[model samples]
Target: MRDSSSSSSKPVLTIGLCFLVALLEGLDLQATGIAAPHMAKAFALTPAMLGWVFSAGLLGLLPGAFIGGWLADRLGRKNILIVAVLLFGGFSLGTALADSYATLLVARLMTGLGLGAALPILIALASEAAPEQLRSTAVSITYCGVPLGGAIASIIGMAPLGEDWRVVFYVGGIAPIVIALVLVVWLKESQAFRAQTGEKIAGQGMLAQLFGPGHASRTLLLWVACFFTLTVLYMLLNWLPSLLIGQGFSRPQAGMVQILFNLGGAAGSFLTGRMMDKGHARRAVFIAYIGMLAALAGLGLSTSFAFMLVAGFVAGYCAIGGQLVLYALAPTLYSTQVRATGVGASVAIGRLGSMAGPLAAGQILAAGTGVGGLLLAASPGLVVAAVAARALLARRNRQPQ
Candidate 1:
């Protein structure tokens, strides 16, 4: 009876813990946008400088994802995740305490590293914990925490905190430190990782494993899809509120839109995962990309608050939903031996796009481009992402399950 209960509860526990960490990550990611107006005033930053502020953390994520994922394969996922949580949590506090622009950038960079490292492991842990048939749903469930966390940050931003932007970072930093402690006490190492033989553990070089015969094409396609998909998604995430504010909306009103966006993202993430698990992977992919295109157009064209609200929700639904689909699909592309590494590398490459999105948006906006033009400009990339994603899925379908 004890054995039966333990077996039944293990997956739930793992998924639940991962969900908490993902929630913290989401909060930290969104906190920047939520605090941007105040941060700019506090630090006397320009739009281009603000863009660099956003990208600084993302830059950290690139290396963090690569190195963290690589090490998690050798070290246990639980161990690496704990350290990542602490690293991000601590620096998030640093972000709150930063007195100068340079200090703020360093804090965000370090925080991004932690956030980047934690994500691939979370995906891997959730994927490994669930039954094969339910892997997508499990990952989606874990990922839902992200937008939900973002929603929480939006709520905080809306509060009358006297424009104390540091409040967001303080909350973002402290919670993860607490969660890391809980994880240490309760989180278990991934069962799949423990089951590998010594020979497999000592297997091929990283380059060979990722780029070897059957993997090269899939890896490149995944990178392409991830890069473009994240480019659009992160742009929306880091800039949507600012864009809305730029168009003469009040900060509170923009915060409300941000909240709705995140709530919509949570719903989209959950539903897409369910659809993928029910053998509707193709349909899910189609809806994700097509919906994203329409949402971008809607966001670009909308003038009224009501229309903007609708557009925000749809953008969250499609953009974030599509990202969840990618996260769910990535783990299935490689063997367990290199699963974290593969997922991390894909995430790292995607971070490059994520980094580019904000910086490009900042520069474009600085160059006097309107929100409409900037958003419309992102359309071509989505088309490219859709094509690559479809091709990757088709290739995966042809392989043996």
Candidate 2:
């Protein structure tokens, strides 16, 4: 095991690798959503069927997170992450040739297992290697990969083949294989993790430790936050393009709007990381959520393409921006012994929200509620999340500074 405590060569390389892994995590999330419309027509999918495609991957994620967390503690982060990348990358390539809706569904589920494992393990490794003064910033910077990946997926979805979303999937899937190969040659195990593993962590079970008394409250809150955030974020990400197309934008135009949304998210993520580094974690999250609420409301009322694009950017900014807080916050909430467990639990819970987002949006669209109506319906979740962030911040402030 290698400890990255000093300002040295391996720590820098490890952080860079963590950044790449983080990007892949977000890219996988955006793939299904950005390509949803094309996928729907290809399979002649009903709204419910499309919803299932989104949820299937999320379902796999729950178990993946749990198992990956436990494995990180037992076998170390490097090995588990390499396996996850290969698993997801291989499954994503398999999706390119999926002949039936059922086959596609299964591939997504398998991909979710791999994708789910990547985040926590990466976060755990980055935190271990980062210097204390820069830890939060590094964690948040690594998290920027999600929005950047999502943005890339949107850009790729706009390719000449138009609605043949399979191309995007193939590219995303293959990337992890490349990453895994590189990691095998370049990376090493974390020294802090290695030192602790032989002692208390040796016989610990993740499930038991995650639910243990001292950690119970923080664990519950982490899950609640993740669930709400994912539900809102994924619902919008998965359905927004189709919703725009329904409003009369062509598929290409709709994808373009999705690109703008990702662009805003990417910008927001970069700024959030910088601000969190400068000690504005709570303010940054609160303001971002406020912007999200406004963007959603504006989206419900606007019909102009320009307005929609602007609204999409703002909405994405707030929606995706909060991830910075989650990435930096989750690891710190628990001790090193359960760091992976905490991150895995938060992500697993969040997947529940992610699964619900597409389902609820699908039902609304199928029922003729329209995109604006659907967005308005979803706004309350953001409001509640804002309130929760405030409460959490106040509590943290009250704790001795």
Candidate 3:
């Protein structure tokens, strides 16, 4: 395995490639959501049917994260990531070709598998390459690619991409294939990871090591935090556009609001990531969650288009932004040997919440709950996550530094 530690060249290249990977993840994952309304029309889907379309993909992510991260620990980050990129990209292209709801469901599940596998490896590689002092900032900077991709998806949806929606997947599918080729040539295994040897890592399963003695409490809290934060974040990602359309915004206007939300998310990730590097990881994230809670409450009360856009931006800033910080922070909880596993497990657990978000929202919507009511319902999750972040910070503070 080649190590990037000796020169900035490898680390920089690794982060850059991983960033592109994150962008692809966002684009492909959000595709179904972005295409949902049109897809519903084409397939004559009920609200419940559409919700399952949103969920099948997320549910697939669970196993992918667990299995992919486990493999990365033994096989190497570069190896698993390449496979993942190819897997999702190809499946996404297949999704573009689907004619029926069942076909679309299966294709999204396959795409989700590939999508899920790549993420933990990407986080692990970025963390491994970043210096200890700047890890949070570096990973968050890299993580910004996610929202950037989401914004791009919103752009495509708003554009005359046509009601077919297949064109969106075509574009998303192609980008990752190109990126996977680039990774093969430029991305290498982490230096710290390289020194450790697979023999040592193979001695214990990544999942077992993740929950092993000293890591238990933090792991549980991290899982809890991830569950609630991602619940709100993904609920928005998968359903916000539809929610807005229901509120009477034009399709383009809804698309634009989603764009603003993701762009705000990118900005939030950039700023708070740096804050985490400056000894405010806990407070910064806690504050971000608090911001999200307030924004969600405001959203529940507001009916104006302008106010909704502003609230969407603020909510994305806190929820999606703080989620990226969680990605950066997860690896810190474990040793190099299990870092990928830790990140992967957090993501896998988080996907449970992600999987439920759209379905839960769908039920509410179907039951005659307005978008405001749904937003209000979502607020408690953010509040719980906010409390958890404060607890996590206090716990870490009392123990050592």
Give candidate 3's root-mean-square deviation (CA, Å).
2.3
Q: Please tell me which predicted candidate would have the highest TM-score against the true structure.
A: 1
lDDT of 3 at 93: 93
Model 1 ranges off by over 4 Å:
200-205
Model 2 lDDT per residue over 1-401, tens place? 24544437777888889889877777887788877877888889999888889888888888888788768877889999999999988998877778899999999999989988887898888888888777776776677777788888888877765556788888888898999999999887887788787665534455455666555555676676667777788888888877787888877787777888887887777787678778887889877888887888777777888888898888888888876667677777666777787788787878888888888888888898887789888878877766666565555555421
By descending lDDT, how would the candidates be arranged? Answer: 1, 3, 2
What lDDT does candidate 2 reach at residue 7?
39
Evaluation by TM-score, superior candidate among 1 and 3? 1
Spell out the clash pairs found in candidate 1.
none
Q: lDDT of model 3 at residue 385?
A: 80
TM-score versus the correct structure, for each prediction: 0.98, 0.93, 0.95
- Give the winner by TM-score: 2 or 3: 3
> lDDT per prediction?
0.91, 0.79, 0.85
RMSD of each: 1.2, 2.8, 2.3
Give Cα distance to truth, residue 239, candidate 1, Å.
1.0
Which parts of model 3 have CA positions greater than 4 angstroms off? Answer: 1-6, 202-208
Q: What does candidate 3's lDDT look like per residue over 96-148, in tens digits?
A: 98889999999989898999999999888888898899888878877888888
User: Which tens-of-lDDT digit does each residue in 72-141 have in candidate 1?
Assistant: 8888899999999999999999999999999999999999999999999999999999999999999999
